[model samples]
Target chain A: MSQPGPDAPSQPLRITVLTDGDTRPPGLERIEAEADVVLAHDEASLRKALPGSQVLLVTDFRTAALEAAWDAADSLAWIHAASAGVDQLMFDALVESDIPVTNAQGIFDRNIAEYVLGMILAFAKDTKQNVRYQQDRRWVHRDTETIEHKQALVVGAGSIGRRIGTLCRAVGMDVVGVARREKPGDETFSAIHAQSDLDTLLPAADYVIIAAPLTDDTQGLFDAGRFKAMSPHARLINIGRGPIVVTDDLVAALDAGEIAGAALDVFETEPLPADHALWGYDNVLISAHMAGDFVGWRDALIEQFAANLARWQRGETLFNPVSKRFGYAPSSQ
Target chain B: MSQPGPDAPSQPLRITVLTDGDTRPPGLERIEAEADVVLAHDEASLRKALPGSQVLLVTDFRTAALEAAWDAADSLAWIHAASAGVDQLMFDALVESDIPVTNAQGIFDRNIAEYVLGMILAFAKDTKQNVRYQQDRRWVHRDTETIEHKQALVVGAGSIGRRIGTLCRAVGMDVVGVARREKPGDETFSAIHAQSDLDTLLPAADYVIIAAPLTDDTQGLFDAGRFKAMSPHARLINIGRGPIVVTDDLVAALDAGEIAGAALDVFETEPLPADHALWGYDNVLISAHMAGDFVGWRDALIEQFAANLARWQRGETLFNPVSKRFGYAPSSQ
Candidate 1:
């Protein structure tokens, strides 16, 4: 693999975008005015477009066509994903290549943080049961718990988790963050503990929010044992990668009443099957994998990509560079 | 009515409580130890207990038995309501009498503030629809709006409305409060507008929260003309008295899609009848009037009363004294 020189290219750069059908990024006109744009949705289209493109914009991170067409990516110098996690693109072929990869990280932090706060307040106020009563036209007056002064244990200490901690603290909650390493606390968290302290923290937490990335150390981290360690009244919220939680163990925990409730936005499988037992639990709140999505997100992603493109043209380092081995953008970036 | 001297009472003070059956305030034993306590549920019981009683505590605000038996209240010197609004106790007899009225004001401020935040976040996140889709086990992903930097118009300047504004500001919202008189802006609100400015404010607000008391000027304030002046995408939340909004006009506005959605915790009628049309609207969220109720709210109310009882024994003015002519506790009290 040869690196591009700092000198400007003699011709316009060719940028190819891989997206699902009908998933065009907004504000592409800003990028199109300065580059040759090619939109590809399938393996055949991607392979044909990959041969001449110098930059690849993976708008649909779920597609595996990138791995299949890597052999034809002769002119590809940089890859940018329109998602926070680059796990799908970290296959053996790309990992061995020299092309630098960047991701859209900071854009989703506040949006996901707001979503988690909504779930916490919803659980504390019994909003799900309220809606159910509304549907049945039942006037049921019940007491609800308060989140003020309540403890929250965030399992991840990344940007997203920090934002969640900040929002929770703003509402008078006591926040503790768990990361792979113990560190000095910031304004958002009172203390950051090592993962080994999860068992100790679980009992004190009224809410356990998962915002950790999917890595070898985190897969299946929340099993029956961990659930059993938590307080019976504590709730679990997963806004991170789905594989970090064992779905079956969570169902068992709910069935046995080991925990009060859960709100799951992601699953081990995409579009969790219609027969999934998790959906049948009255205490569980489910949402499609959209915790970080907001209206006009596509336009925001395009703007971020365009800014990075300008830096690339000047041979400056990209903004949110991801380490292939780590599977996520480092917090420092 | 003879004015009591500033000296301690020579005899035990007679304290009568008006509450629904099986609804005694929590921690009443502490008060019972010092005073002669009488509990009354209906008009006959209230009349039997009112004679020679110096103080009345109205825990059930819906009761009109007090008005029916006002003639028997020969020795009643003061009345304390376990609610923020004193409309139920604001009969002509009490308003024109020498007896002073007080209410539970500060107790419900934080609780109601949290509830309003829950509703705002729920609407912005589309949480009610999320639960519906969850029940059907359908994973349909959709974009949701964000509440950050959104404009909120709170139509009250009381403790509860102020707290709501503070919490909304904590989550990055721009808050504008409406009161009868304009005041210097506090940290919670950017500006406090007079009632006359609502028409101009309504057009720009993304969320309009009603927390005003049930007063002559506020009754039927949110009618068809006001609703028409609001943006089509704005949402309305009512945690205040029900009569402040015309129920029929609200229904018509919602049916016509003039507003995006609403979350109504108060209604023109309590225990909103099962056949009510408001229950059928998919865009509206309905809850029983328990927004300010937390797990131990009864105990908190009793504690507040006990503190005020000490001041009464000393023949001093009570806390939270209401303006009988105004039908609510004035902010200064």
Candidate 2:
């Protein structure tokens, strides 16, 4: 509702790009040609460049520079994130501000869904064991479980979660989705339940996938009680935000055999310290949080931002507008 | 055509079982009640037991004792293999005889298809690299390939291959099937080609899956030339017989970077010796011949044979009859 009306500003638009200086987003020349653009690589630079800027284009999702420079933003109208999850950008001031926020959401759904399915199949076929045995030059013939007719419970019935459910069902899995609000089942999900029903749903799931956004209600969602509710034969896959799961409790669950295993792409502490206990487990699959990053993904993210920027210049409603109260775009499902 | 007429035999059926003495097939009490059963553990036992038996049920797929005891099968009316591939039972004398052979075909189609899909997804996602990184406790972020709209070429458009095609298509891949005879494409495949079209189809496929049976025509089907024809980005998956691809040529292909990688479940040599070079490649995934061997698969195989036995008792046509001339069942595709 805070989106600007259809009246173009008389002055030239000013945009500030906060980057980490690793790689600059490509295909931004056209945007730079018409606007006064400033690339801020650090908090001091961001603070220096924030004054007189109407748009903040955040390329570094890991930096807290924007919040540190918030007092300098005297004329900011909007904030645009280059990533799907806008958790890093949702500081207290921004959440309480009148500035509207948008994100790169639809670009990542398919690739992330594919990544989740790959992890599910990897566990079912025991690919990691195959690698370990091959390394030892051992030919151990083991019987693996079949994914067919197995149950998959995906938490988060948003675009990414629905795509995960669709792919799981494609491979003959009985898929059920858990959303914040209940909806009628479609081709992808056999049923959709409210978040409160997760406890009852966990016991029958062969694979429990977390694709929910990071929100106040979802933080620490997969704690001790949730893990204990899961079937011991189930695997936990978190492609969602890291803090949604308590790391120590997950370690304990793995130690006690409360769950079969976990394929974690995100963590509370990233580049997870060398001596982290999760690294020592044979069943854990640790990825470097690159689930949605396919080849040429940087360009795709930039393209999405550029399109949304065009809409902003003309004072039109934006795509993927985040609901500040909920910390994510509420589902139309 | 060799099946007996629908007239109940006055004498009780004499059945011989060829086993390697490891484990006996379960759930045969009902069959044993109506038949004179003899369990043969070796070549000498098989020869001694074959003189009066009208049916031979083979449980040991790797044994050559059947060929050694062929001369003693004077009263042989039918042969049933407890495995999908009847390659070991297809000796010259058996192939040249009027006696019919049947296999456990339909029992393995879905599981094998699932295995093939898992391998395809593994290579696309770089799961082996994740395992290696986890072993070193390193966090290496890398972009992976998306399987959506990728092309998959399936060699051998029989029940197993068709199932693989169907599953690949379910995940949004463009699938093509290869068979002995060309047929119009169905819901599973975008097109169907004859065996001769493999050369043209090889270059375009992102994944080439071998699901053909081991036979005179298919033996050494993938040699140096076939490997050269495949795209450098393509990964080869073999869930079919081992000799379908030449191991030495595969090694050379890897050395020359002819193909991206291979996920081999079968090899020309069983237990793929510890000294074999295939075990050393980071890109190659070596799995013991267990692609279709899900939990309870042994019982499933026996169950298929039992159903066939019931039909044999009623003098009706058998399921999965081998062509003998082609060394496999002529596919209905």
Q: Kindly report which residue pairs in candidate 1 clash with one another.
A: none
lDDT of 1 by residue, A1-333 (tens): 334523537756888999986767889899999799999987899989887688899998678889887787878889999988777798888888888899998889888999999999999899999999998999999988888999989999988899899999998999999998888898989999998888888998899999998888788999999999999999999999888999999999999999999999988998889998998988999999998999988899999999999999889989998888777787861
Which ranges in model 2 have alpha carbons more than 4 Å from their true place? Answer: A1-10, A331-333, B1-8
**Model 2 clash tally, residue pairs:** 0
Docking class of 1: high
Rate residue A132 of model 2 by lDDT: 94
Task: Kindly list the per-residue Cα lDDT of model 2 for residues A34-137, writing each as its tens digit.
Answer: 68988897889998988878888888877888888788887788889887788877889989999998888777888888899889888988989999999999
Candidate 2 chain A, which ten residues in sequence have the lowest lDDT sum? A1-10
lDDT of 2 by residue, B199-265 (tens): 9999999999999999888999999999999999999999999999999999999999999999999
Clashing pairs in 2: none
For each candidate, the alpha-carbon lDDT, in order, equals 0.89, 0.88
For each candidate, what's the DockQ? 0.84, 0.84
